[model samples]
Target: MANLILYKQTDLSDRMTVNRSHQANGGMSLFRTTSWKRSFVSSWLLRLSMFLLLSLPNSEGKAIWTAHLNITFQVGNRIISELGETGVFGNHSPLEKVAGMVVLPEGWNQNACNPMTNFSRPETTESWLALIERGGCTFTHKIKVAAERGANGVIIYNYPGTGNKVFPMSHQGTGNVVAVMIGNLKGMELFHLIQKGVHVTIIIEVGRRHIPWLNHHIMSLFTFMAATVACFFLYCARRPRMPSTATRRRRQIKADIKKAIGELELRVLKEGDKEIDPNGDSCVVCFDIYKPKDTVRILTCKHLFHKACIDPWLLAHRTCPMCKCDILKA
Candidate 1:
């Protein structure tokens, strides 16, 4: 009898050990799955960051430098002087300082598009700068016309209605020629002064450097990326904690079922026992006839089953297979 009890105890011990091992393996699998997902997302985000960085314009090129203009003219026996960083030089223009008396084209059209265009100034005037409008041809054509006529510098104004907005001109191949662009308003002011026969002179100087493309575009890209990362982390933080909690609950329920099964009555059937008699009812779970020395589990309803068949059935269904009696409540 002692040996039989020890054997049953050993069987329960083995089942508990197997259950713990299965739970441990399940936990490890869950950890591996979560880690792989996190790594994939991190790598994808890193690649997206690199692509954005590569798509930006090159920052190593020379910065666009502004030009400061200082204008001086005589107005009704008074000398007026104005100065501001209101001009931008041509892409190919020299950065060196230049000063000269301002002059205009000889006709109603001030664009200076005609190669034969001339400046109505005294031939003896040593250094002169041409003041031309924006449209009517390419900037190179107008600048070349002025440069060909021995003008020391060329100043092209922006289109009308542009207010004070100005941008650098791209007039390549105009070698060693000093060129600058001023806003329509500022250019019109200079044009009127020179047209009214008021002697006007301007000194052009280099101003501060700027990187407008880098400042505007790169900052926008950075803001978008930062917002995307913040949202991803917020989603991760708010997700429900499901894996550990569900696994722990299942383990606790399995332990309670195992303990309840152990508390139920157990019996060993022997010869002449009514349970082992030839006409006695067989174990309903397995539909097998009980013989001598058979281990049977007796439920509260007086129904019996082979221990091997009923143990797992009770664990899963929590009720006797024959009478539907609950072992834990009994």
Candidate 2:
């Protein structure tokens, strides 16, 4: 009876300890979850800020603008015409449509590097466009020289050996001037025709517009969002699994059985003890008679058995060997 009371007290103590441990673990889990949420929010905000910064317009404060050029030249008795969006406007050029006869500088050098470069204009042609080579001076200086020479518009070609490559030129302080750049190959074709004194006329009109930096911003934002979503799913998939209700109950029962086993009374058989008698019932586990100095255990049902044998038996069965009494209920 005393052993039964001690077993019950031990079981109850174990139950309280498990409950306190669970509560403490729950509190710590809540704190860690809260901290993780805060960190996730902060990380998202930082990514959003970077995305916004990347989405901003280019620092040059201007987007690339393309120009469509229509050219008509008289070859023999037939007039040849061609049209394509093969030109980019200068950064400071005015967005306007202009048309005129194409002309070159007065001297052998096609680049209007000299501030006093003169344009040979036909007496009958009221408006003419200056065709200049790109080199030897700043774009601003060339455009200014052409504009001051009574040219209606300016068209600068790219460097030699560069076939159809063109970019928007940075020509500040040349206000309201209609300046455009063509590829070196295209420029050479026109230059030869104009040099041969073939009458060439061109019509320049605004074409498509493009923002080069916008694509990078969009791709970066998509990558960041994808990574964040993948991380969230990975975390959820790897989180620790909680114990089921049935599993918890099974664990608690095992703990109770161990505690009861530890609380059972142990005794040593002596020479005069009845347990040492030859006529006494043998241990059900080992089928052996108890002898002097043999260790035995007393169960709550008043049944006895060898301590070594009953300890393993109670752990598996949790009951007395003879009467089948449950130690936990006793």
Candidate 3:
């Protein structure tokens, strides 16, 4: 009775070990399956997000809200287009046309270190306009000095080396009524005109212009996408097989040529029929006149040639040698 109880206990322990092993294996398999599915979903979502971000344009980065200057001056009763360069709108000014008399600084000494800085003042009887030259100081320093002198508007001209290109100006602590930068060439033109007692006026207006770098990149991306789409549609719509009309026409042409060759009249030429002229009436293929007793073929176009001479020509070209008329077409 003791041996029987021990055997039964050992058997029950073995079955429980086997059941635990099977359960562990099944659990591991389920975990692996779930992990794989989660990984795949995460990868797909990442790719989709990247695609959307690239396809859409960021409005803040690409398009900026700014204003432009439309400067015009009078030249002897004629309001010509004196607007040489448009200035980027400056800070601290309402987007309206600020018209003022153009005035150059005393001694034209616009250097920031110069003690005699002349700027327009509101308290003055006339509107004071300050014209300054670029360089010798930061734009901020120049504008700040001019503002201290109570200038209504400040115009900075480019240095000698700087080309006729207007760029956006940024200055710190410059209380601008209206601020603008003109190209060296345009600035000199206006300066000499003012010196000659010619009155000039500038108009600042709110306008839109291209933003740097961002606009270019966006346009390039759009162009690339457009080209890619065009190519894809062309490939999808392309014909894989030869055109039916062209194939059918080629077959008909070949068949007609063969039938015409079969129905052609072949005869042996006698001495009387061999009265041929070498210069004017000669076989264009062999460039020889017809010989007596020679076997010849006459085309429907009335052109005659030796059988051997015309056979190869007709087989290759399917046309009359002299007239170039298509025997198949006829």
Candidate 4:
């Protein structure tokens, strides 16, 4: 989703750091920082917060990454669905933005399904993890079948003659679901491993070049750095503007909100729930749009919400909408 000044690959190497070399050539550091390290807890908390921030679902073009393989520039339907930038290879590809790489169901053959069907299994899917063929049908048809079968995840394979990085994916034609593609040359092996019950690992990597938030958080550290330099100058001249009481109060309020929001989001993401947590997690029972004084109910999922808001939602679905935690489960 980046409108980057694409620096095409002139030479690919693992021995050198791109950021450092670029700094040596271009005079500014896009990938390097000189800030002093914080404490261990602070560093982990910062990283964890960053990872969570980038992991949230994003609209197309909002989630940006590098052009690792000179792939087609997609506008409406140029790039078929990639599980985000993390699914591909290369140092510039980041893991933070990816939903997860997908492995298509093995043994489902496309040519076998032709001629009005010699297919044994009914074309209907029974699991959320769907199996789809590569040929004869449009990718949209494959996704539709999988989704109709209750799948939130879709895996599309390359047809027999499908070439790597050739066919483009168009999202304008399908439902909103996380889908990943596997070319015949690369994905065939992983397809077989899945057949052996090997748990598929959805590898998401956020390389230094791929993180956009580094620009924002780096400002906080840099401001702190600027303040330190100002203090040094103040000591030399013995004159400095004191921080106003209002400024301090505003900072305190902002910090309180950030701390609350970050901790609450972390809990919600980790526990996989959305209802109000009566266990001192929040004021409301999950996010049932509780009123100021509405009575709320808490679930074992540690989520709380307005009793009024959840009665109907739970009637049809017992899981929290935010985290997918089962609210009805004990």
What is the TM-score of each predicted model, taking all chains together?
A: 0.56, 0.53, 0.42, 0.28
lDDT of all predictions: 0.78, 0.81, 0.61, 0.41
How many pairs of residues collide in model 3? 1
Clashing pairs in 1: none
Cα lDDT tens digits, model 2, 1-330, are 122223334543555465456545543443454556455545554544544453453334457788999999999999899999979888899999999999999887999999989998788998889999999999999999999988889999989976767878889999887999988899999999998999999999999886544544555568678877876775676454655578889899999999998888889989998778788889999999998999999998888899999998998999887888999999
Which lDDT value does model 4 have at 288? Answer: 35
- What does candidate 3's lDDT look like per residue over 1-330, in tens digits? 122223334543555465456545553444454655444444333433443344344223332224344555677788755442245444434345555666666554645446566543235335545677888888777777766776667778778755555555666466546676666776787778777877666655556544534643565467557655765665455544434578889878778787898788888877655444444466778878777777888898988888899988898899998898888777
Tens-digit lDDT string for candidate 1 (146-195): 98998899999988987667766889888877999888898898888888
In candidate 1, residue 186 scores what lDDT? 87
Query: Candidate 4 — which residues are off by over 4 angstroms?
Result: 1-133, 161-163, 171-173, 203-330
Instruction: Estimate the overall C-alpha local distance difference test score of candidate 1.
Output: 0.78
Q: Could you tell me how far off, in angstroms, the CA of residue 35 lies in candidate 1 after the best superposition?
A: 20
Number of backbone-clashing residue pairs for each candidate, in the order shown:
0, 0, 1, 19
Q: By TM-score, is 3 or 4 better?
A: 3
Cα deviation of 325 in candidate 4 (Å)?
Answer: 99
Candidate 1 regions off by >4 Å? Answer: 1-60, 212-221, 233-330
Sorted on lDDT, highest at the top, how do the candidates line up? Answer: 2, 1, 3, 4
Which predicted model would earn the best TM-score? 1
